[model samples]
Target: MTVIPSLNVPLLGVAVTPLNRAELLAHIRDAVQEGRQMLVAGHNLHSVYLWYSLPEFRDFYDRAGAVVVDGMPLLALLRIGQRARLRTEHRIGSTDWLDGLADLEGIQRVTLLGGTPAASTAVLRHLRSLGGDVAWQGIPGDPWRAEDVDEVAEEIRAHDPQVLLIGMGMPLQERIADQLAARLDVPVIATVGGALDQLGGTQSLAPRRLGTMGLEWAWRLATDPRRLAGRYLLEPMKLAALLMWRA
Candidate 1:
């Protein structure tokens, strides 16, 4: 059994295990090969509140096979406070990982959910351009309806996609994945917030150098100040609170 170290982040309200990129990839590959259902979560403090406030969202995390760390701040906290033995070398955002996955052949069918129709279309086109044999589907609009859940699940089952990528953002998408997980036997269901926008060209990712330096948040804030100013600016205050609580 591989022992993964748990990070002590009080605000998260759960023991977060640190799995290096390779370990994470291997875990997903093994899960797919074995035909076992898995839920993948990428959550921050705000998203954590979204999960705790919503029962459905909370249940999603509870059922996930793995919830990898995505936020740079979260990684910093883990490294500094938890004394974790993991390297903070790479920031494996779900969108980047999915693109990399697309390059690999004979893996599994991928179903994309969430984002606007236009964004979803771009995602499909990009994946096809990458020579990915993915079976893609998109929600009609931005916010998905509960009624559409079953229909989406039915389509996914018919396609039998090994991986389901939910981009509905935060608690909503995570809740949807949890509900759908109970109804279907899909191998991997990933809740990736705004990744579709990044993949679809509506939004740009931070340059590789910025990402490597853990300043990707700054890049995002620079790109859309009006949209991300409050979220990114206020995140530090929340981090302070978490650190105090841990102390």
Candidate 2:
């Protein structure tokens, strides 16, 4: 059995567990069967930066039931520490969870709460293609707001999905998942960030080779400089600074 440890990034208020694909799926099944509520978040390097720089992000992560390191850069850092010993072949992520969830038995319905209409449709379609033939549904949404909470929650309650995936992007997804998990009777809710965006053919992710080398940030920055330049270029400096201060 793989023991789960909370890899604390002190001052940032994030406690991540080095949970690979297998462990995450098993944990979710157990949590759901026991009726245990979970506010799970997948954290990457950019997530770490946001968690530290944005107080709200930090707060949500701190309150989460489980946080998993979802990017290779963070996984590389963890490999140097005693907090975890994850398999090197893959950086387990929310997408892996989708596969894991799909492989399991008894997930009747799944409600997706974020991403554009097209992305939601594509992702749902893909998830349904998985082995268990999971029914992937969604609550139609656009540029989201706190006021939409009631509507979203009502939709979730109506669907009563066994699983909920929120891909509303970083802080917003985390915030919305936290709010929804508080009131909804759903079995499990995971804040998957932009994992659903991969479904949108337009939102191409970095290639596997680059990702394995922990250079996915570079690929993203190169492709979308206007949007991700600062994120990929400057935010990692904060991580280095944090490490230096800790040392």
The candidate that achieves the highest TM-score relative to the unseen native structure: 2
**Which segments of candidate 1 are over 4 A away from where they belong?**
1-6, 10-13, 48-56, 103-106, 139-141, 238-247
Query: Tens digit of lDDT per residue, candidate 1, span 134-170?
Result: 5565554385778887888888788777778888777
Off by over 4 Å in 2: 1-4, 9-14, 131-133, 239-247
Q: What is the lDDT of residue 228 in candidate 2?
A: 88
Model 2: per-residue Cα lDDT over 1-247, one tens digit each: 1224577543444567777677777777777767776767777888887876788888877776677877876676666654555665437666656656776766667888877777777777777776585666766555787898987898788878888988877777877877887788887788876677765453777776776677877887887899987777787787769756856
Q: After superposition, how far is residue 88 of candidate 1 from its true place, in Å?
A: 3.3
lDDT of each: 0.70, 0.72
Residue 83, candidate 1: alpha-carbon lDDT: 68
The clash number for model 1 is 0
Clashes of 2: 0
How high is the lDDT of residue 162 in model 1?
77
